[model samples]
Target: MRRRFSLLALFAIATLPLLVVLAQTSDAPTCEIVAPDLGSYIGDWCAIWIRVDDPQGPQTVENVTLTVTTSPPKSKSFVYTTSRYNDTFFYANLSLPYGRLELTATAVDDSGLQGSHTIWVIHPFPVPYFNSFDTPTIHFFESWGEDLTNWTISPAGTWHVNYSNYHSPPSCFYTGPFSGPITITLVSPPINLTNWTGEAFLSFWSKINQTPSFTIPPTDYCCVEVSTDGRTWYLLSPYIVGYWSWSFFGRYSLTKYVGRIIYLRFKLVASSSGGGAGWWLDDIIVGNEKKVLVLDKLVKHFSCDSLDEWTYSGDWSVCTSTYHSYPSCICCGSFSGNKRYTITSPRISIPSVNDGQDIYLRLWWKFLIDQDCRVVVQLYYDGLWHSIGEFRSSLKRWRSSSFWITQTSGKRIKIRFMVEGYSNYASFQGLWFDDVTILVFNRRIATKGNITGWFSTENSLWRVTPIRCYSYNFSLWWGDTSTCLCYYGVSYPLDLWVDLRDVDHAYIHFHAYWNFTDPQSCASLRVCYDESEWVLLDTFMGARSSWTTRQYRINGGCVVRIRFQVEVYSSYAIGFFVDDFAVLPTTSDTASPNVSIVEPKSGAWFNFTNVTCVWQGEDDVGVCEYEVRVDGSSVAVELPPTTTNY
Candidate 1:
């Protein structure tokens, strides 16, 4: 019988372990201390544990939370979910205060059964070593998340907020029935960002729902105020008050003392002059969110570029709109002078294309003017019509003029041309345009000057045309004068002269007419250095055969005797004309040098019986001087003295 009792006792002890687990499992799993067996875990060493369920057969738990309420009951909720007949685990690694930490894990299923376990957290504490230094200050846009712990947030409300692009003015948010002065609070205190230049704005989507809001219903007044400190506030200008039914999502901008350690607040003084329904505000955006100035291109086609078409940078289109439609101007030709042979291409809508970017609408025009005339270039901007820079052409030369539209309003821009006549008839033929370029002028180089005579005296003639009529020191030789010589021929040399006053540099230019016959008729440019010496500085030939123009820089001092000698003429012969003569530094005296040096006692005996002499001679205008010594005496001399050169 004693032997039988021993067997029963063993069976009872074995069943007791299963019973303990069954009780815990029937409700919720208890967090069992697996690693660092309870008493063995003395000092702070990561304590971990696991639970074994011998009963309760795979039960799911709900409302499972971890409450670490030590001296203070702080709790963090954890979601515990498990498939039927499966086991689940709960884990956390937190720095508990160096006291008795009361850790409780509880689970309540949807059926509402509660099971909890408490662990005593004690720490002898391993002395942790920490070194601190100034970490780099991090900056993030308003779009960044709030969970960034390593970074510091300034201007309070940076924490407990999130950003989403889904919003209209998209911004940061915090769940709240909270309203107070928004401020700049450093997340990592003691680390201050000095002279910070941060700007933030509050943008919300609002719409005038009812008609009263649009008609200025009774009592709504709103204002945005800012402050350098969280306390003292200053009201900003332009406050919204007395609403109308049409006013919807409202937005206010505040920018005065931003970047400063300041606070911003939005206050609505509800005063319904008589008081009705207030407006609704949604999608509020706060924090540093900047709106990008977006530019949208509307009509890209400016013109139809046919064979004689124009190339452009952006999408090219025929400028067309409701008010105006551009004509098929692939090739621009003048129909007549009195009636402008104008082909109006469509207009294009350009919004904000003037943002420090280059804008050019280039078109080519083969201006075959049968007579002297001017072509008017027009441009439209800012709801008004205007002209590109004015350009007039009489010959077959290609010319371009541009206008400026400070900022693009809409995408549409128009370019128009008009032929105005100062004379009988004018026309443009064989005109073409490829790409357009808009030149931004920072500063323009000075390029205008007086008329100097053309070197080609015979083969080339300067007609008294409006664009050619220029007065200079040489104007005395125009007509009915013995000195004013005009000799006309096919290919030959001609002498032209102008009595230039004080001048340093003279700009010489000429235009050659090409009939395509004389393919070789070219003018050789030369300046007479002395009475007999002609220095060929540059040459203008048939390469510049088509409406040819050449500019030469002549050093001013001696009066220039200019000459143009034509090399050859052929079947494709054409007449050449030159105009637009300019002399720069018009005050430069070109008179010959006069010198009489005075110094060192002329012809006087120096030390050790050596004789020395010096004299100073001054020229009323310019002096090209050199020193000459005869019999050991310094004296006024000529440059490349006659004795030396000879």
Candidate 2:
């Protein structure tokens, strides 16, 4: 081979002169810590790799070396071998202790040109630990095997350990504001719950402070998440900072993952456009606790002679002697002017009841006022107070009153008593109440079928037609569908009826919406006890854009019929619409009246000539009439049918 120079010898000899000249004039070789960059958490045997490159040739590179300096004053060095031309690769299998390590790579060319790069790496311990950051000196590793003791702070300057903004004593971890788009997460060690039983809960306290402008788009969001494997996570709670306050996120039941190993992490994400005061967290806990639900019925009798279950606002007291029965009664009294005294009963619940069952409130009360004082009973229903009944005039002795709690079968309710005095001349004795009772019974009529008696004549000028959705802007009633008694393009009256044959003390309820263009346009709701005569129950005048509930209570009757009449004064007005029409039967009062002679004792003789007599009368529904008699001769004057006294 023409003096037989080997290939290796020929390559080295051909590049030797060129490599020496290039190394003297070229820049220093560049070095980069490609593997395990800054802020990386590694294990015991970490493979640290570095790449060194030179612009000259591979023969221009002299040596590549790696030096790892760890805490506790320990150091190690490794030399790398080049495997490719113009590029040198260096790697070391490092058994790093649980601490921070400073990795420096240096590359020196044959001409004495050198380049160096330095990075930081962390070796963290394994999990199942807690950290409060209370230690005086910040260390990369703790004597105990806790990963958070050697937690990696990314980019080196974003996180801080301080005593401010902590819920508990000592210190907490805080993330300061940064320049632009950043995501910081504080992760907890693995919590092994594989052998635990029952229910488990995770709870923590956190506070966030941010700019308090509503117009700005929210750029900061914080949440807690849990992971089974470290790669995937499920969010627990996500919140944006609306105000600066300390909030305790109490136990969130993690019963769904009772028997599995999990990890908890708090993540904070922020954007550069809007700045904030950052987030603070402390007192994190995970434990085994079960949550309970309450589902119990309410029952109160007031038989213990105590007002403990009631709340009163104004002049109220408990009296032991002057009551309906022996033990006690609630006494409200001595009111003047237009002053009112109110007492509210505790909240009571009625579980689901059958269709035809009835609920009643029974109580005994006595009032000593003359004319200007009244006692009104109200029931709280559907966020409003409805007056059930009232007691006026003088009742010198105890009387019983019963009210039907209709339309509230499966709800929670409260009963309120209001005593008001309109004048100063009323009696000072006030009102006395006792023996409050709530009872449920099956007293309603078993007939529960819909009335099949709606009549509309096509030849008539006024007819009932389905409401047109396009004409009224698609405004719907309670049932979203309705019928209107329309006399379109005319000014005539419309009539509609539904028959109720044997309904006893029934109520007719319907929803109505009307738009009257003219002032004289009106509608009248009526009921007929006899076929020829109609009794006006209610009348609607003027305009109503929204639906209004209308109800009428009819006395027990065999030939009852409900009718609606609408009259339009002008043709420009849109006719009325009615929906959800139903006849509901109420409980009938069958008990006789309770009468007592309170004044003028039975065997006592009268001394004066014009002795005014007083007596008490009460009934469940009402005391319709009262008749007075002396030795069965009807000597006393007759009182009105609505009178409760004589």
Candidate 3:
């Protein structure tokens, strides 16, 4: 029996699924330049991160250094103190002058073998130029502030960059030691204050609460200092006597330093011991011109479940099988297709950039046609249809694409997506596009008010992204720039506060919209309440043609916080899109809103255009807006939130 069992076991083992495992070899680790891909027009700040990988494991690889070939082309090494992409990188920042630079990132494994990757970078702005800092590392200022070494402590900066309390929603220069008293210095690079009038000054936002330390009022204060030629320094005032609660927007004259280049720094004094959320400074403007950015989210949602707002000329049809959203998408020419098809959208009246607004054209689509075919997106206005974009390549997956409508903004234009293939026997099998929308973003700068929450982004692209943000960025350009270097994409992780103190149960519902080509891209929502450990509520992946509704329930808690995080990789199909977020006391409703006609009886006949209809509706919360449909065709939309007769 033992011999028979042994023979049977051998046969079972041979029939089991095959597994493959790789062991570490003596090969040297390789360096992946995760950022500033090849050639990037660098602004005032330049950040370089390199992913160092080895067969033994990226963590086992030792030191990584970056060298720039400038000024006689000698290699200068910089210390990379951080790792990213699941511990596949060692990265750092560099301050360089305006010109072309060839950067070499070299990594060495524990075995002492070396690997290197080099790329070119250009800093176009001339020094003494006042430009914004959009990168993670600033070249306009040489930071004496330290890198973030421990998550338990504040990050590097003499005036540490903190998010606890802010004049801005997310970050500001702050000083206060959470663990103990420590002095940090943040100094500016050369600021040529030459040729300045008496009005030329330096200014920052501060308050007494910035230095409300436990040790003493004045000891833990934030000191503003200045220097010329980077040597001797002098203190500037309102000389601190005591800390206050109100914010002081101070503007100090720089008339004395006008003849030469000067330096400025915020000093966090050593006596700033004990726990205070720390001193805060933000919106440090050197001149009088203030740049304010206020984001107003205006979304025009058009359901593709039916193509009433569209027209097709050829083989295009509404498909339901595979879509970014559910139920439908207008498509034509499937895999290996060769047919000409044209679809036109209703005239889109976009607010122009001159109106302090930008228009974003977002759509979800997939194409599997041949290279000989062409997909052209054209805008018809000003007497003729002008081409906005054209695609000749083959993309087979459902993808989200965004277009920053330039030149065409402010014009009422009709868009046409035309697919022309010379072949006779190709079909897209339909289901190529859905959820076409026009997003209008209006920015009002210099507006005073708090506009942020506990939202943070890890990538430099998200820090100052121009478009596609609801107070946060989903990508460098909400479109396909293909800057897939590091985990080089969008990672929007937001913390939403929910008070479930007295409630027994609550439901969280949100409309999730996404189209990610990379299998690694994903989104998650985690909940924490009543001082409990973080509990995962749910996670979502895969592509969708239409929006998906997800709801999770929390039984009980005091103050609750939900963290919604999204990490995208490989493609810029779309950014993290989760909307209609709500925390309700009950999971009573997940269906359509209830509506009742107060005046019109059921099945009553009335003239379509002459009759008046009075109706009232209530969604789970309350009525948002109402749309009236007659015979399944919308006659009126976005009616007043208040129920009324139409």
Candidate 4:
């Protein structure tokens, strides 16, 4: 019987006492390995602690063991028993070579029921330098042996490193104050450039604050040089002129010297008698190539050979003639009587200051008048129409118009040419508009004096007379009246012009009353920047009467024209009255004055009585006087010039 016993039977007999002790418990023992988190790098020594528990009782757990398996072809396993107080703890003294190691801990109960947990640890080798200077001390190198006499590595020179000054943190090397003539070279540690096979670049942020009085000689300047071997060096960058502001210098390709280890050095040579502030460098990165994106300026020309970049409404036709530069030009308005036609160009995008440019529009136009027909140029921007200038061809000669587009930076805008005719009394030859072009100029030299005359109208000083007025009742805010009769099948178009040379915004307030029989009969109020096309502001149909106020924020153009048009198609319309038409221009007011009329609400009606008028006015500078107007008319009441209320 002793000769026939197997190896498995012998191992069971050897552990029979421990198995018998664990059989008293019902549940398996649980083990958890806590110390040395995943991906943790372990050096010479690492502490590992694990907790093992048995639901039956702590005494039911017999032993806890730890095993470490090292990764590689040399795969070796190290096993050890840990000491336990409440839980098991293992202080591992790792002796294997550096690599990845998997540590597993197992708890075996007295009944041979086991539970285990495993974790991976990484042990990485050290490198020389990839320093950002984010820590207290520099990690890589000490001072070089040869560079101490003329060049100093002190921080408190004429150029110092502070949080606001330096491109990166902590400190940077500086070389300055050589008294007379000196040439010094600052060297860097050897960088491995063999791995960078593709296009490689060395970039750094540098600032040089040379005194304005110090005149730098042509031969004496700072330059960058690279060295394959420590003894020989090649010039990498051009001589950089010393300036006061921090600027970026980069994209120096090292494609020629790709497969070699190299060293970068900065050579500073100064012959000037005056000692001045030197250069400061930070955030030196040597890596792959980097790309930067920028916006391009646009220039467009439409010869009108075809209608490729143009849109039209109503009747617009193109004619081929030698009157313009190109073979063809855009022509409109050949109708007999009462026709509205428009030709709209494609939208063009305006380059903003961020795109490093400014923009302008230019065009040539002419009109042929039989009775009362005009050609107008208008700009479409920010969902509104702006009148640039208006043209009526009494001589049928081509005229040119060019204006700087101000308020449309970083926006898309379009151009429109509108031709309108009112009477069919005679055979009329229409309007001609052609040769459109747009130009984009660089903002570097043109950006100065960006504050153009934003508010040209000072204290409502400028007033505009209506260019053309037709069948409408007109009464002054405080003066006389003109009357016209209501009639069907008639069209009335009133054109008013305002000079917006330096104006930024204009507020127009008026009282309007309209009574019409047909639902299609309407009174439309429109504005234009170039006066070539009309943009409708408000349209009133059927019967309506109210005091309406509208604000026009003007962009960069010289003139603004408004047109009030009333057309009755089938039935009678009466009392189309528009009064108290006021143009108030608030120029570029840096600080707005506070104004209040406490006595009456806006659009409030009053009767003849003993009424006390009160107002409150204040400004950051000082309120000069309160100009009180009753019913849109200034009352001639004597009061103090500095009076805040009436």
TM per prediction = 0.19, 0.24, 0.31, 0.23
User: What TM-score does structure 2 among the candidates reach?
Assistant: 0.24
Clashes of each: 83, 0, 18, 18
lDDT of 4 by residue, 322-438 (tens): 336535787775665777678888888765654545455766666556655656668899899987544433324564545446457778888888777656653347666666777
Local accuracy of candidate 3 as per-residue lDDT tens digits, 1-646 = 9999999999878766442111233477888787888856565467878877787765767777777653111122334443444567666666654345567888877777788898976554221111121111111111111222111222453345566665545555555534336655666645654533323456566654433444444555567788886669898754453455435444566667765778776665545343355565665545422222223444466667877888887766777677765457777745455666788888777665656765667777866543456677777888898765555444445555655455666678787888876565544433377888877654333211211222333332222232222221121222332653435445655554544555566666555555667788777789876436989887767777765556566764455666766677665655545543456664444577778776678888866767777766756544435666678887545434224211
CA shift of 280, model 2, Å: 84
Which predicted model would earn the best TM-score?
3
Global Cα lDDT for candidate 3: 0.56
- List ranges where model 1 is wrong by over 4 Å: 1-303, 306-329, 334-337, 353-355, 370-372, 395-403, 407-411, 422-430, 436-646
How far does residue 360 in candidate 3 sit from its true spot (Å)? 0.7
Overall lDDT per candidate, in order of appearance: 0.39, 0.58, 0.56, 0.55
Model 3 TM: 0.31
Off by over 4 Å in 4: 1-298, 354-358, 423-428, 442-646
TM-score of model 4 relative to the true fold?
Answer: 0.23
lDDT of 1: 0.39
For model 2, the superposed segments whose C-alpha errors exceed 4 Å read: 1-299, 423-428, 444-646
Best by lDDT: 2
RMSD of 3: 32.5
